[model samples]
Target: MRATVAGTAVTLTAGALLTAAMTTATASPPATATTPPGTTASQPVLVDCLWQRTVRPIDFVLACGDGNSRLTGLHWEQWSPDKATAVGVNMVNDCKPYCAAGKFHSYRVTVRLEGTEPWKKHPGVQRYTRMSITYADARPDGFKQVMTYPLWG
Candidate 1:
């Protein structure tokens, strides 16, 4: 998956690059082709910049290259194979003069992760391919209160 990161159009395949670096994600149990669909539930994943699957993460970085944008205080409302919802705070840096001297601001957001596909780095694992952010109030400048983005696979 590839999408805009912190208003910058960027594509990342973190899982492919650093598959063995981190192992903190809570992946679903391995599922084989013969496994019954309803017998077991396979939850999707949210991969972080370090190529780690971030399972119901409380804090997620939106800008992987820099610490400019991120989500914090996430309280998951639902977590399933195809969709996940959460309420959190989006923290964005106001790069007025420059990025180096920017100030960070917070915005309330409701997050939704949708779509599922095989995680190439981790077999038998799936990952959310799309992300939508619905801001409650005081959204960032030049951005919509609500927006959807694609996730890296």
Candidate 2:
């Protein structure tokens, strides 16, 4: 419990820095480009599997089919038109024998969202198309520290 709480703070702090860097690099993006129906952020967003437009979402489900992999306790590092990044913990179920019998585990990870395309469902909203995760420590068995996946629209 203590570790999880501490990790949230670290994630938020890093996200603030990333936002600052993105602001400096992008130099004031168009005021309304990122705004859709509910919010007023100028940077692009990641469309979660549920089809929600999100900026700096606290958590994201990586596996839509089984919910086996997920990123939790996210802190956005930077959010720009071209890219969005965060530091978070990835929780995965290692189904030693089977998913039903699998135990869940958590690992520190750095997540990056990239690419941009107009969302097909919603007008005036752009979504990130790619995602990459790099484990910070203690990755699950038989996996590399880094992995990338194509985010669903």
Cα-lDDT of candidate 2: 0.84
lDDT of 1: 0.80
lDDT of each: 0.80, 0.84
Clashing pairs in 2: 15-76, 18-77, 18-78
Query: What clash pairs does model 1 have?
Result: 1-153
lDDT of 2 by residue, 61-124 (tens): 9988899989999998788898988999999999879998999999999999999887788656
| Per-residue accuracy of model 1 over 16-92 as CA lDDT, tens digit each | 44554444332543223223354333777787666677667888888899889999999999988869999999999
Candidate 1: which stretches are off by over 4 Å? 1-41
Best by TM-score: 1
lDDT of 1 at 97: 92
